[model samples]
Target: MIKQDAASRTIEAIHESVRTYLKQGLTNEQIIEKLKEENLEPYYIETVIDNIYKEYEDKKNLKNAILTGSILVIVGLVINMLSYRLSENMNSSAFLLFWGIVVTGIVTIIRGMILYRS
Candidate 1:
């Protein structure tokens, strides 16, 4: 029980320190040196760094994707409306293409939300 408690605290400490260093915008090498000084195992340090970096990148990418998807949807709609107004003879084929673009954007947004949640 005592060993488990110690291990848990160690893990928490490592996570906290890593997050702090990340927030400070320290480089990877500086973070590694600081972790080594804290007497953390090399393996734990590497794993934590990789995990944290991946997590942050995933979230960042997800946000960008969602924004891009929304933009695509809006642009598709605006173009469709303008085409309809400016060219009264906008044919079925053109409408279908615009709808396809909107659908693609919606699908992209849904996928991004799923990834962000997970």
Candidate 2:
């Protein structure tokens, strides 16, 4: 039982290390080497690194999507307000385009928020 407990704790520590190293932008090779130095099995090291990379990619995509969506919404609102104030003789097509931009921006923002929350 003691051996089992020690082993579990060690594994947990390794997982924490993996997370920290990934956040520090360590490459797979470097992570693997560090894990090896800790005497972790090669298979476990590879698996952990792969999982971390997948997680990192997911987080990065979520952040990028959120930023892009926010920018689009802000830009759309600014353009719409400017056009409305500046142009008294705006045509129907221009109006449609302005509204379209606003709608698209709103949709993107909603999508990004959903992704981030999930």
Candidate 3:
């Protein structure tokens, strides 16, 4: 039991190391190189690295999508406001484009949130 406990702790430590390296903004190659010194099986290292990196990338992408979406929505609203202020009867095509930007932003944010949750 003692041996098993020690081994489990060691495994957890290794996993934590991977996360730490990732948080430090190390490149994938750098992380892999660091892991290579741990005497782990190549496949094990590859699997762990891939899974962690994928999660990180997904999170990053989701954040970017939400931010980009929000900016687009704000820009659309501002443009719409300015257009109306300048001319009460704005061009239909211009309004259409602004509305489209807002819709696209909404879709992007929704998709990002959904994908992150899943």
Candidate 4:
């Protein structure tokens, strides 16, 4: 029980140190070096940094995907409306192309939604 308590305290201390270094805007290398000086394991330091970076990347990607998807959907809708309004007779080829754009836009939006949820 004492060992477990000590381990918990140690983990909490490490987390606090990480948060402090991050708030100070230290680079990952600097933070790693500081943690090393504290005798923290290299694996633990690397894992923490990796997780932080991965989460940041995930958020960025999610934002980009959602924005792109929304734009594509809006563009597809505009194109369909323009085609209908501008053309007296819609050709079969153009109809197919319109449906294709709409389908692609829908798929992209769905993919973005999935990424956001994940």
lDDT of each: 0.84, 0.77, 0.83, 0.77
TM-score of each: 0.71, 0.61, 0.63, 0.65
Which model scores highest in lDDT? 1
Candidate 3 lDDT (Cα, 0 to 1): 0.83
Model 4, 18-90: lDDT tens digits are 8788889998889999999988888899887776667677778777777777777788888887777666365
Alpha-carbon deviation at 38 in model 3, angstroms: 8.0
Best by TM-score: 1
Greater TM-score among 2 and 3 belongs to 3
User: 1 or 2, which is superior by TM-score?
Assistant: 1
Q: Of models 1 and 4, which has the larger TM-score?
A: 1
| Clash-forming residue pairs, model 4 | none
Per-residue lDDT of candidate 2, residues 1-118 (tens digit): 9999999998778888999988898887888888898778888899977776777777787777777767777888888877765565664334423666667767776786677567
Candidate 2 has which clashing residue pairs, if any? none
Worst 10 residues of 4 by lDDT: 88-97
Can you write out model 3's per-residue Cα lDDT over 2-80, one digit (the tens) per residue? 9999999987787788899888988767877888887777677677778777888899999999999999999989887
Q: Under the 3 Å rule for N, CA and C atoms, how many clashes does model 4 have?
A: 0
